[model samples]
Target: MGKWLLPESLADILPAEARRIEELRRLLLDLYRTYGYELVMPPLVEYLDSLLSASGGDMDLHTFKLVDQMSGRSLGIRADMTPQVTRIDAHLLNRAGTTRLCYCGSVLHTLPRGLWATREPLQIGAELYGHAGPEADIEVLQLALESVRRAGVADYRIDLSHLDVVRALLETDPAAAARADEIFNLLREKDVPGLAALGPDLAPATTQALQVLPTLYGDLDVLEKARAVLPALPRISQALDMLAALAKALPGVDIGIDLADVRSFNYHTGVVFAVYCGGWPNAVVRGGRYDDVGRVFGRARPATGFSLDLRELAGLLAPATASSAVRAPWGLEPDLAQAVRALRAAGQIVVQILPGHEHDQQEFVCDRELVLRNGAWRVEPLASAEPAARPSPSTAI
Candidate 1:
């Protein structure tokens, strides 16, 4: 491979896409600030023990570990930013009431999630700490939806699930408890034959429940079908009720229920969801509640939030409208320099055409120019200049 060849599933985010991601980051961070989510930035690497303590269970496989020469203890590059932010919320802030926190940064995954996925993802998300009700869940859900909407993703959809439902069903049987891993895999794959293979050893009722999980997915009405089919256990019922409440809150919104949609992050204790956009084969965003993630840090708070790949979201957004530019001849004259600075400060894209250049200044789409017609620097529009095929000056940065 060439020296510049990037590893599979890892590529450079070029100028156009990088600018799009940066702009979206600013917009979403501002949105989070409005909701009282104070911004936080956790270190990219930390001691393996503190970094992975509780979440280390779910994150071990995805983390890249190395020995710290200074302490001789292992260190890990974070694969997920959630646990780090959780630690900060629990130990550093230690606020008594609810804490709203948000973060945006890059995380290094040991491997790509799928063939189409990136190993290094720009993860941006929000978390609500110290609140333990469906109310917080609803808030996070709304924020996640708004993120997609603001990105101009059309016809987006959401699929919601409660891990408690599956946990409730499994806790009922000793046999199911022993074979929990196998049962979980079978249900997730919706493998009826594999589940039936365990019928002789597993209870008939538990086997039946596991068999029905994969099919218990679809529109909101699927909840009705689930109520009729699944055992009328309190935990299961409670999970269903929460889903129903969300559906009611957002009428006509495309919401779905998938009882078997378990997340890889096992620390999550309650509701979980994945958001999708039109024509995408996989989810564009994902998150859920992980109340116990803070236990290792000595404070366990109810936390729910969603994270999306800024690069992916940027790719999904519609092309942004181009801004007109003012082409100015480069000079150190006080008036001209002041005009250039003023234009830029007032939010206009000003492209300064430099002096002593060996090349022609045909790069920018020069709609207007800073001219000195009346002794003072003045603004003038070009009479017959053709627009240049280039990215807006802002994006080029």
Candidate 2:
């Protein structure tokens, strides 16, 4: 095997893609900041129990576990950052009022989440803690849509689901409740046959509701259908009302409802959502209310946030163009050095060409050049043809 070869689902991000990812990261962090979200960077690895405390079984299966060398406790490479951020809010900061936190980092998954996905994803997201109202969910959801919008994703919609709806139906029958995990898997797959197979053990109403849930997807009309068909459980009605309220909150945006979307059943408690774009078969962003998550950290606060793999989101957009740069000659002369420093300080990408590498291709497109004219460096546009050729160090005045 080639020494440079990475594992099956892991690959290196090349220069172009890396630049795009970095740019998007900065843009998102800035967006979060404007909303008063303070940035927090949790370690890439932590004690297993604490790391998986709020993530549930799905995250547990994806996390890479190892024994700590010094402490001898089991440690895990985090597969998600939400729980870590939760711990920070619950234990570290312990702020009495609202705490808005955002994070961006790498998370290792045991396998690729999709056919073309990478095992190691650069996850970026924002979480809001200490508020349980629909307003918090509304704020987070709007920010999520704005994230992709600012990233240049024009065609996208948000699919909203509330876990409480499913939980309520299951609670009506002990047998259905006992087989909650299996039923959730079936619902996510939209496996009507499998759901029907469980009908013998489940109550007639529960069985009917479970089967009908899969078909209860599409636009706002699905909510009306749900009310008429599903059992008249208060929690179910409340969950449906919440979904309608969220859809109403975002009037211009495309919205969807999927009652059967229980993929995150174990993790979220209410109003779960996923943002989907045209080309990607998977959700680009996933988040929802997880009030119970903080409880595990000894501070049961209302928490809701969303995260997206920057790499995945970047893939959906057109490749970024090479940034325009200023070509400068490599030199130790005080004037030349000072000129280069000035351009750099002014937020320009100044590429200094070495003597031997004058004809080598550069990652940046040098649209302008720093030339010495009349004993002082001056900025001038390069000849149309000059930009294509490697910058010449000998051209230094």
Which structure among the candidates has the greatest lDDT? 2
How would you encode candidate 1's per-residue C-alpha lDDT over 1-397 as one tens digit per residue? 7899998889998656777888999999999898889999999999998877868387898999999999999999998898899999999999999999999999999988754789999999999988888889989999998888887787889999888888888788788888877877777677878988988887888888878888899998899999999999999999999889987877768998888887653677888899988766768899888886898999877788889889878877776544467778887888888888888887877888777662464434567677776567666665544655332322111
Give the TM-scores of the predictions, in the order they appear.
0.93, 0.96
**Ten contiguous residues with the weakest lDDT in model 2:** 388-397
lDDT of 2 by residue, 1-397 (tens): 9899988989899999999999999999999999999999999989999998788766878889999999999999999999999999999999999999999999999988886888999999999999999999999999999999999999999999999999998888999999999999999999999999998899999988899999999999999999999999999999989999999999999999999888777888898999999999989999999886888889899999999999999999997777778878899999999989888988878999999987678678887788889898977777753445444343332
RMSD of each: 3.6, 2.8
Relative to the true structure, candidate 2 reaches a TM of 0.96
Using TM-score as the measure, the top candidate is: 2
How big is the positional error of residue 344 in model 2, measured in Å on the Cα after superposition? 1.1
